[model samples]
Target: MATVTTLAPQAPQAATRAALRTALRVGWFAAAVFWTVLAVREGVHHGWPAATAALLFALAPDLALFVGLSEAPRTARGQLPPRAVPYYNAAHRALVPLALLAVHALAPLTWPPVLAALCGWLAHISYDRAFGYGPRTKEGFQRG
Candidate 1:
């Protein structure tokens, strides 16, 4: 005969929601500063429309994310579920380019939108990863 012992499993701890939020805030600030500097330089080179469009397009994705996330329940802030994030992220990522592609086709294919979209996508990934909301783990909030 052998004696058996088992330890109770630990409860799931809350995700590092605050850290994720901080990261997003900081990331956006940094991106903003970077874009401002780049815009000033581009404006000097290419003039106002180029610079304005660059900044606007760069901010579009973050703005879209903010709008969507703001509508979520208060409890769902930093812990947005992976399933929902991809949808929001995908839409945010696709919006400007898709619109550009639809409207002018070739004009928006230039550098500014592409660069801004890339920055936005990177920001989205960083925000999600900061909150531990990757595809493999169901660590964040879930929508019914």
Candidate 2:
């Protein structure tokens, strides 16, 4: 009788990485829920203008898609346009809206609609992160 042997799979690292990725996604999802609740609360407290602002700001970042639709050349179909990469990245960063919120906290005046907008923006970014969407590379492709 002949005996055959096979090498062990080297999937531990891969498994670990996948687990971490899942944990990160869950964290982002939790943040999304928190921010969404806050946004809704702000809009409810402040009325129609704030609600409208929140709704608009939530969808604003995605408007970057329109840039890809323009005449600018792309590396592939459905890829973001190079011209729009900067705009999309900037809008998607959680830090921008966070900084705005911090500024709002410190500034002398109160703007309810702006606060609502910031909350909406944070919710949008958090949801994107949760779904594994993020800033694209300069080449207009998803970064690894």
C-alpha RMSD values across all candidates: 8.5, 3.7
Ten contiguous residues with the weakest lDDT in model 1: 135-144
Judge candidate 1 against the unseen true structure and give its global Cα lDDT, from 0 to 1.
0.49
User: What TM-score does each of the candidates earn?
Assistant: 0.37, 0.88
Candidate 1 lDDT over 113-143, as tens digits, reads: 4444444344444444444443322444433
Candidate models: Cα lDDT each = 0.49, 0.89
| Backbone clashes, each candidate | 0, 0
| Predicted model with the maximum lDDT | 2
Model 2, span 20-122: residue lDDT tens? 9999999999999998998899899999989988999999999886775664563587578888899899989999999999999999998899999999999
Q: Enumerate residue pairs that collide in model 2.
A: none
